[model samples]
Structures are given as C-alpha cells and as structure tokens.
Target: MADVTPNVSLVATPEAVSFLQNCQLPVQLNAMTGNPAHYDYDAEINTAITNLQGKAKESATLVARLTQDEVRTSPLKHQEASKLAGRLVELAEGTQRLLTSKAKGYMDASSDFMGKTFTPNPQREGYYLRAADWISREAKNGEGNGYKAIREAVTEDPDFAVAIYNTSHRLLGLPKEHAMDFAEKAVKAFAPAALDYIEKSQRLDELAKRYPAFIAQVRSSYFSPFELAKVRTYVEMPS
Candidate 1:
C-alpha cells in the first residue's frame, strides 16, 4: 500500500491576517475557504474597492472646490456657496433614501436568518421625520438666512435642541472663529434632547450599534478643514 501522507494546515500570511481582521467575518471566511470557483473572487473585490476609492476622491474634490469658492466669496456673494451647499443637502437626502432602498434590496436577496434579521423596521422614522422637518423649515428661509432663523427660533424657545444644532451647522460657513464657540454651545444645548432620541431609538432597536459614535460624528461634522482654517485666521487677528 502506498504510504499515507499527513495533512498539514496552511498558515495565513501577516498581510492576509491583517486584512481578515479588518473585514467582516463572513467575507473573511469566504476568502479563506478557497473553493476553486471562488479562487479569483479577490479580483472582483479589488475592483470594487478601487471604484469606491475613486468615487470618494471625486466627492472630496467637489467638496473642496465648493469650500474654496465659499471662502473667496464676500458675504454679499454668499449666494453661490449657498446654492452649492443646498445642492449638497439635496444630494445627502437622496443618498439616504438610496441607502434605505439598498438595505431593503439586501433583505429581499437573502434567505434564512440573513433575510429575517435584516427585515425592514420603522423604529427611528419619527426621529428622522422630526429632523427632516426642521431642516426643511430652515431651508425654506434660504441659505444666507439660516443663522437669523436659528437665532429667532432659539430666542422663542431656548430649549429647542434641533434649532441650536442647526445654528451650529449654519455657522460652519462663517469666517469667524466665533463659529467654533457657537458649535460648542449647540452641542451643549442639543446633547440632552439628542441623547433622549438616541436612547429611545436604541430601546426600540432602531439604532443597533455605534449610537455614541453616530452622535459624535454629527456634532463634529459642523467644522471642516476650510472652516477650521478660517477660524484659526480669525483667532490670530488682533481685535
């Protein structure tokens, strides 16, 4: 009889191990199993990754151009940047809808727990609706007028968290470092209300994870690189 050979397990390379750690477990496992039919799957994955990177770069370029244009414009010239920011807001709204649709598509595509667990749910719809309504009201007043409306709203109702948050976001376009102070004030004003919504949504299983990170990101997004540079200039100038 021919001598039987012992089976030796293959070890993952350092690079492969690092990649696996970064990826979701199912994807990592699929790559490791190395079924012949899936052997070249990395090519498709790499292509997708490259495409995503290119898209992100393009978006970043657009945002930078918009910011530069805003900086160069006078207060009287705010119309141009206002229009661009409005367009961006519209794009963000559309992207959110698209994401929801895609999630539904994924739920429909899968079977068993994969499908069941990802089924459509309406837990945070109310919170989103409230936020959207607030944003819409502010948008109706026009871009340059956001700060005024926010101030009026806050004056009428000092406890209005959403209005305070909107004020912070509006100030992001301003050249003065005072915008940072406003942003901090907004965070303080909105934290309680925002946390209440977060807790309620979490209790309802709407926000499954990363709730704190989500809130933090929203708060921080008020200041971009261009805005920070402007703020710094304002700070350095003598009164």
Candidate 2:
C-alpha cells in the first residue's frame, strides 16, 4: 500500500467525508508517472486500481445519502450534496484515465523483469490465442454466452451499467482467472483493438461465433503496419 493510502479497512457505507476531502488528484497522477522498474508492476497497478475503486465506493455512499428521500426534498442541500458526490466520482475517473495512459511507460520500463513478475507481457501475440481458447472452452461448457444477458441488462437498466462493468472488472482481478490474464495480454498487444471494441460494439456473443475472423478484423483495422509485423513475428516464434 502507498504511504498516503488511508489506514482504515472499511465495510458498508463510508459515512465520513474525510476521504473526499483528502482525495488528492495530483498525488494520484504523479504516482503513475514514475519509472516502473523500481516497483512491482502488478502490485503498483493493483494498488492504483484499488485506490480508484475506494474513491468510487466512497462517492457511491455519498450519492446514496444524497438520493435519500429526506435529502431530495431539500433542493439546495440536495444539489450541494449531489455536486460533492459527483466530484468524488469525477476524481476517480480522471485518475483512472491518467493511470491507463501512464501504463505503457510503466510496462515498457519494467519489461526486463517481467519474467519474474505476474505482469502480462505486451509483446506476445499468443495472448489473443489464449483468449480465443478460453472463449471457445467457455462456449463448449455453456458459460461464455452471457453477452446477450449483459446486453439485455444494459439496455433494460442503463443505471446499472457501471455496476455490471465493475463486476466484470472484479472478475478480471481474481487470482486464478486466466481469461483476464489473456485479455490483458491481448489488450497490451493491441490496445487500439480493445478500445475499438469498447467503443463500437457490445456483441461479444456474435463475435465469439467466428472468433478468429473477429480477431483478424480487430487486428487489421486497429493496428499499424509495424505493430502488425511485430505481432506476426511473435505469432510465428517457436514457444
């Protein structure tokens, strides 16, 4: 844990406003920009993620309080409380964006020691292969087609999109979840592809039917010639 992280191990709602008052954006931003060679990349990234999650959770509690019927009846107080709650969420989101942008620097700097760490290797194209394999296995077992459920739920309950996404994010951090490992590798292998997927589609179900072709589509459309060449080299390398 970072020296600045709060010592409290929390449960239920964070009733205290100190966390909001103490949420320092500049400190969080600067923490991500340092050379990652000196730190454990996996630990540092997890810490950053946890911090963001904490802020969001705290903000959620405040949002709940603001949304309570009693608070809603008082217009000025309601507006002020809502504004403060929104600020906490905004702070968390800004920190997330800055950290993701800083990740390439950290990963690149820490590449030499990756063999000894749990951090995913960005240069490996086999990551896509792993994701393909995992998805295929999931399909066979009838566990991976939840994209339809996700889409339906997202459409029917847009207010819960963040909650659903957060559940997926938690699953990604689970210790034995190799799907996340593969996905992380694939993302670093071709982040633009992942971003494009996030921006353009929610149809993981349809794509899974022809996974290889889908992968190719993402690769060809989002990756540069040089990056494609590197991926091809990695693909053809003897494991």
Candidate 3:
C-alpha cells in the first residue's frame, strides 16, 4: 500500500514560531538600491513586485480565513503565523513600492533623459534595499512577537531569494551593495538546508536515513509556500 504523507502545511504553532524566531524576515530601507540597470529594470521589477504582493495577500487571506472561522482552528494553529506572515509580507512589499522609490540612486538620470529610466514604483534592486530597511525596523520593534514570525524555507524564487538575501544583509547592518555577491552568499549558506528535501522528491522514503540537521531543514521546506512563513524568519536573522 502506498503510504500517505501527512500534510505539512504552515501553521502558527509553537514549533513553527520557535523556528521563525531563529530568523529575521523584516525588510529594511537600506537593503535595496534602486539604481537603474542597462536591462529593462522596471518591467522586471513590476513583475517581481506583483508576485510579492500576491504572496503577501495570500498569507493575509489565509490568516483571515482561519481567524474568521473558529471551526477551522483546531486541526492547525496557523492563525498566529499566518497573520504575522501576511503582515510581514505586506510591510516589506509596501515599503519597497512606496518608500524606497524616494531613495537616492533609485533612478538613472541618463535613462530618464532617454526615456529608459527605472520605474520609481518598484525598481528591482532598489525595492529590495528599501524592503530590507522596512523589515529591519519591524524586526527591531519586536514585530517578531506580534506580526514578526516565519517558516517559508528561503529558496531560489527570484523575488524571494532577493528578499532573503537583502534581509540577511540588512539584519547584519551591512551597507547595501550593488552586486548580488552578498545575496548569492546568503542563498548558498541556506541551500544545503533544502538539498535533502529535493532528494526526497525523487523518491518518497518515510524511513530514509535522516541526519538531524537534514530533518530540521527538510521540515522547514517540505510544506513549502504553505509552511514557509516560519522558516523565512530564521533565514532573515543572524546565526
């Protein structure tokens, strides 16, 4: 008989909270630089921002559902996590689009003259830096307690990776850099955490040899978009 895998959805459980507490999910104003690129920066950034906004809403919507209906509460404790995740996403995304545009280097004077300038709405790199700053304030303010928490395993999602990388750098209080060197380093540090989970995808092995660290990593991501908020917090925080 094919064994059924238990659903590993994101929930606002103590375990999940504990995991998130190990992370830093807030976006800060300094983590992004809206400098214009030779590429179609605005178009790319728009697509990226849209996606992040959706993610924010998705978490918020789920949390709303769980809270509005008490009947839906017992099987899972996703309430606290969902609410916080939604808030965090919203805060980070909002700051990127709204506040970061005003930062210096957000626009390219050369591109502007040529009508090829970046969109102040949400420049790719700029947005990240701004989002990181916003998140930092929230993180430092103990938003981690109220709307501060996480679990979505940081991965290669373009927008998310940018967020994680930016957040990691921001939490460390690094002056944001133009190159992706820092973000890449952040991703590399966490890549091993998701490797085991990827391996499991090839063959679902309930009793596969498990390393303690591997198990911890797998659990954070196995549930994915649904179980990620808690883990995101961990990645954003320092070691």
Candidate 4:
C-alpha cells in the first residue's frame, strides 16, 4: 500500500470528503458531461488501427524517398534525413508492436472501415483480451501492460473511468450481474497501486478496497451520458 493510501475503511460520502481534505488531498466536487459512445474500446481500437495503417504507408513512402544515394549526395539532406529517420524509427517500432503475431490476430478480427464502429464478440470477450487489444492498439509504443496504461489514462482524465464502465456495460453487453466483473478484478488484481492514481485520494482508495462493486455503480451514475455531457461543458467553458 502507498504511504498516502488510507486504510481499507470509509465513512459516508460527506465524511469521506472531509477526511480526505484533512489529509491534504482536498476533494473538489466538479461536474462534467461526456458521450458514452466516445469511450467504447472496440471503436477506439478500430480508429487506432486505421490510423496506424495510414502512418505505416506514409512511413514506407518516406523510407523510399530517403535512399542511401540521396543521403550521400546532399550534406544538407543528411541532417534533414537524420531527423526524419528518427521519426520513421518511432513509427516503425509502433507498427511492429501493434502487428505482433498475437496483436495482429486481434487487429485482423477487429478491423473496420473508417467512420464505422467496431463491436466486440460478446461471448468471447474478457477483460484480459480487451487489455491485450488496448495494449496493442492504444498503449504507448513500449508499454507492455494495457491496464496500467488505462489506469494512467483514467487518472489523467477521469472521463476514461466512465468510458471503461460504459463500454463494458453497453458495447460488451455483459449481464449486469457480471458486467463490472472487470472493475472488481481490477480492484483485487491491481489493488493499492491502481487506487494511488485515482484522484490521489486516500478516501477513494479505501472505498475501492471496501466496495469495489459500488465504485462501478458510482462511476455509472456519475458519468452517465447526460452527466458526462454536462461535465464536458464544464471542462470546455473558459477559465
């Protein structure tokens, strides 16, 4: 457990907020609005793969243009080529990571035309595979764990937490009884490390430890399509 994480205990919401504030992590109640559809994992992966393909083609063209002869002929071009080469190397690495044997299977199974949404196989889907797809299609090029990337993303933008819940609920269409099994598993599997990033709240960490199921419910209501839209407005309005 992090030194900052509270014990596996909580009081009422109001009390929890006060307790956290006393601990120096002030709890600010702010509202935001969002579109749930924006968080669908399948759609996110589809768009990423499409973009990767376009970049792969563009990289290949650049590679063709920056031939050895061209570099040898122009001293000025060598410096430009060096910078371009660095970028192409990054692109190549990302492409390689995304198209590995296992990742390629997911990519092949999940591809879609531009502007079309992709859907997961309901019966076959599991959070592990979803994490794998996320790692391949969306994690930073070198990041190995999709959930860690997801955790960072969620912490960076709480909206991502809503997306996880919404996608699991709507796109995957798992039974309500089991819909948030992933969140529960996340609580147990990742535990303290995961909570450390969530709003930097000892109270929330304790809440997750004590009531993982409730966390999903809270996120569901708090980030509902209607509520998320409001939050988006709040976020976008001028400071």
- Top candidate on lDDT is 3
Candidate 4, residues 107-139, lDDT tens digits: the string is: 333232101222333454564355434533443
What CA root-mean-square deviation does each model show from the true structure? 27.4, 26.6, 25.2, 27.6
Candidate 1: regions farther than 4 A off: 1-73, 111-239
Candidate 2 vs candidate 4: the TM-score winner is: 2
Q: Mind giving the per-residue lDDT tens digits that candidate 1 earns over 1-239?
A: 01101110011234322322322233432332212232123353234333333332343334334334434423312233234334433443443343344334334443232223223236644543454356446645654686566445433433333333333444334423434443344444433343333333332222112223322322222222343344334435578
* Cα lDDT tens digits for candidate 2, 37-149: 32233464446545654654464345344434343333333344445445554554454454454444444444433322323345543553354333343434433454343
* lDDT tens readout by residue for model 3, 1-239: 01111232243455543333233222311112121121133464444434444443354344434434445433233435444554554444443443233222233332232122112235577756655554454445442441222112223234444565535544734444522443444345444333333333222122112223323532442223443344444435568
Better of 1 and 2 by TM-score: 2
- Specify the highest-TM-score model's number: 2
Off by over 4 Å in 4: 1-41, 68-79, 91-239
TM-score of each candidate structure, all chains considered together: 0.23, 0.26, 0.23, 0.20
CA lDDT of 133 in candidate 1?
57
Q: After superposition, how far is residue 198 of candidate 4 from its true place, in Å?
A: 25
lDDT of 4: 0.34
Q: Which 10 consecutive positions of candidate 2 have the poorest summed lDDT?
A: 3-12
Give candidate 2's TM-score: 0.26
Per-prediction backbone clash count = 0, 0, 33, 9
Please provide the root mean square deviation of candidate 3 (C-alpha atoms, Å). Answer: 25.2
Q: After superposition, how far is residue 13 of candidate 4 from its true place, in Å?
A: 65
